[model samples]
Target: MTDDLQSWIGRTRRVADEMATPLVRRMAALTDRSDVALDRGAVVPNHWLTMLFDDAQPQSQLGPDGHPSKGDFLPPVPLPRRMLGGRRLTYHAPVHVGDALERETAIAAITPKVGRSGAMIFVMLRHTITGPNGLLAVEEQDVAYLEAKRNAPAPPEKPAETPTAEWRDAWRPDPVVLFRFSALAFNGHRIHYDADYARDGEGYPALVVNGSVSTLFLFEALLRRNPGRQIASYEARTMQPVFCDRPAFLCADAPGADGARNLWVEKDDGAMAIRIKTRLT
Candidate 1:
C-alpha cells in the first residue's frame, strides 16, 4: 500500500468511526420490515461500508497532486456504470430490532473486468456482523462498474428457496418510489442523490440508486407480503447496480424456523440484486 493511501485510510477510519453508531441506528430504522410482534432489532448500513473500507486512506492521497490509489474506492468510477450481471441471494436468518450488533468489513477482491460493455472494475466486499449473543451473519457483495450505454435487459433467472415457518405475501418495487427513501436514509453516495455526478464522476448513464435502499425495499416487500408476521433476522448481499426510474421485483419465499429461513431478492431483469433469509418469531 502506498503511503498516501495508508494515510487516507487512517483518516477515513476516524471520520467513519465518529459516524458509526448514529449511522447504524438510522439505517436500521430505514430498513426495518414487518409489523409483527417479534423481538426485531434494527440494523444500520454503516457496518458494511465503514467496516469494509476500514483501512481506506485519505481521499486526497495517492500522489503528489493527491490522486487516488488502487485500494481506494474505484478512484471515482464512471457514473451510470451498468450492471452486467449478478447471482442469487441467500439469507442465513432475519435481523430483529434492538439487536446490538458489531460489524467488521474487508475488501474481498478487486478484479479489473472487461465485458461486452467495456473496461470495468468488479469490487467484492465481505461483511461480518455479530449480534449481542454471538456471530449473527456474514455477507458477500459484488459491485460491477460496467461501461455505460443504452442496452437490452439482462436474461431472467430463478429465486432461491428455503423451508420456512410459512408462506409470505409477494411484494413489488417500483423505481420512482426510492426518491423519498433516499432522502430519508441520508445516503449521500451521489449515485443515490445526484444524476450529474453519476454520469460525470461515476461514469454511469443514469442516476444510480443506493444498494441499501434496494435491500430495504425488498425487506419491506417481505413484511407487506406477510402482514402481522414479525421479522426476526435478515442478511442481504448487493450483487448488481439498480438504476433509478426503472422497474424491479422482489422475489421472496416461505419461512422455516426461528433460526433458519430461505429468501432472495432480485431486480427487474431478474438479477440477484440481493439474497436474504429471515427467521420469524
Candidate 2:
C-alpha cells in the first residue's frame, strides 16, 4: 500500500481562478471586517487565499465523507478518515483583488506511521501560486489519514495550563460562523457542520471547528495588535480539535529580536488547540 501511495508523489495539477471583489467582501464579512477595502487594486488578506482555487467536485463524485472521491488527484490511502494536520506558507508578493491567479499543486511526500491513536498516513502537498505580475506565495499543506474507529469515544485528554501571552482576544465560534467558513472554503466535510455525524460517526462531542478558521483567528489577533505589518511567512499546526459554539482565546507573544512571533489558540479548558509561528517583513 505504501508503494502504491508513493507512486502519487510526483502527481501535479494546475488550476486557475480570479480574485473577485464579491468573494473578498464575503471573506471580510466572515471576519466581521465589512469595512475592508474591496477596490480592484486592493490587496486581499493573506490568509484569505484559502478561499480561492476551490475544487468544486460534482455531487455524485463526492464520497460518504463529503470530499471528492480519492484516486484521481489524491492517492487512494486505505485509511477511512482524513483531516488537516498543518501548513507552512511563505508570501512573496501581495495578491490583489481582481488579479487572475494560477496555482500549481504537487504531491511532495507520503509517509505511513503509527501513533497513539493508531495507524496514520501523512501526505504533504506543495502549492505555488502566481499572479499576472509574478509569484505570490508558496504553501506546503500537511494532510493526515487515520484508521477507522469502532464508534467508541476515545478517552479525554487532561487539559494543560494556558501559557501567558502579550496579546489575547476571545472568540466564540457558532454554527453560523462554521457554516459560513465551510461555504467560503468550499469544504463539504460533514464534521464541521453536522452535529449528529460528528458525535455518532466521528466520536466527537459536537461539531468540530475548521482548522483553517482557528488559524485565521490567530492571524487576525496578531493583526489587531500590529496593524499594517506584512506577514512574510507563517506555519500553523492544529494540536487538537476545537468544537463549534465553544469560546477560544487567541494569544500571541511579542515579536522577538528577529521579528518572529508565536501565536496559539487556547480552548476554554486552557488546552492549547493550535500553535502558530509567524515572521513579519
lDDT of prediction 2: 0.86
Instruction: Write the residue-wise lDDT of candidate 2 on 1-281 in tens digits.
Output: 68878889989999999899988998898887754689999987777888888778899989888888899899999997899999999999998989999999999999998865788999999999999999999999999998886555556656645556997788888999889999987899999988998877777888999888888777776776667766789998877899888888889887788888888888888889988889976
Q: Which stretches of candidate 1 lie over 4 Å from their true place?
A: 1-100, 147-187, 200-205, 227-241, 247-281
TM-score of each: 0.51, 0.95
> Over the stretch 146-172, how does candidate 1's per-residue lDDT look in tens digits?
655545544443453333324333344
Collision count for each candidate, in order: 39, 0
Alpha-carbon shift of residue 13 in model 2 (angstroms): 0.8
RMSD values for the candidates in order, in angstroms, are 7.9, 1.7
lDDT, model 1, position 167: 39
Off by over 4 Å in 2: 151-163
